[model samples]
Each structure stands twice: as structure tokens, then as C-alpha cells.
Target: MCVVGIMVGLLLLFAAPGVGSLSLGFLFLLGAWFCLWFFPHDLAHHVVGRVLGVGFRYYFLGRSAITN
Candidate 1:
């Protein structure tokens, strides 16, 4: 999900300039910023978990982990 969010954020950022409307482009940029900001911490958690051999099934409310 973090990977997907990062990819979507990049896509939005790239597409923002071509949107042709200042307001719409700003919205896109904002969305990109949000996506870029939101997902990385969880990704880092996953990375550390993998390094420690701790597996997770999903997040609880996006912060708490539900491990498998």
C-alpha cells in the first residue's frame, strides 16, 4: 500500500503540471503531497519487521500492527 501510494503520488505530481487549471493542479499537488507524506512511516515499519523476521497481516487503524 505504501508502494502504491508513493507511485500514485508520483503520478499525481507528474500529471499536475499538465492539468491546465491552477486550482485543479493545486489540488493534485496537495494530494501528491499527502500521499508522499502518509505512507512512508508504515513502509519503514514493514522494512524493519522484515529485517527482524516479524510478519504482519495488516495495520490496525493504520498505526497499530496486526501480526501474522
Candidate 2:
């Protein structure tokens, strides 16, 4: 997330005149989308469980995970 923020900041800083605002907004939106894509709730818990060497089961409602 920090990296994405920094990248978007840099992109806005270097964007061409008259288009920087649009570019910045687009970059921010893209960053958010990618973040959600990479960190889907169930996968997040699964990853955390693996890091802690514990077993986990993810329950989802529609598309969101319910973590216990």
C-alpha cells in the first residue's frame, strides 16, 4: 500500500501538464483496485495462517471472508 501510494505520487509528480490531475486520480484508483485484487479477504487470512504455522478455514458471505 505504501509502495502503491509512493508510485502514484511519483507518477503525478512527473505527469505532463494539463493531465496530471487526471493521471493522479487514475493511478490512485488503479492502485486501490490492484490492492483489493491481491489481498482478497480469504487469501489474506490463509497467508497469515501460513506465516504463523497454523491452520485456518475461511468462511465467506457472497465474496467477503468472515474471519474468526
Candidate lDDT scores, in order, read: 0.90, 0.58
* CA lDDT for candidate 2: 0.58
In model 1, what is the error at residue 4, expressed in angstroms? 1.3
51: Cα error in model 2, Å: 18
- Show the colliding residue pairs in model 1: none
TM-score of 2: 0.34
| Residue runs of model 1 more than 4 Å from their true location after superposition | 52-58, 62-68
For model 2, residues 1-68, the per-residue Cα lDDT tens digits are 44565555455444533354776667766665555555454566667889999865654447536587
What are the per-residue Cα lDDT tens digits for candidate 1 across 2-54? 89999999999999999989999999999999999997877888899999999
The local distance difference test score of model 1 is: 0.90
Given candidate 2, what's the lDDT at residue 52? 96
TM-score of each: 0.73, 0.34
TM-score of 1: 0.73
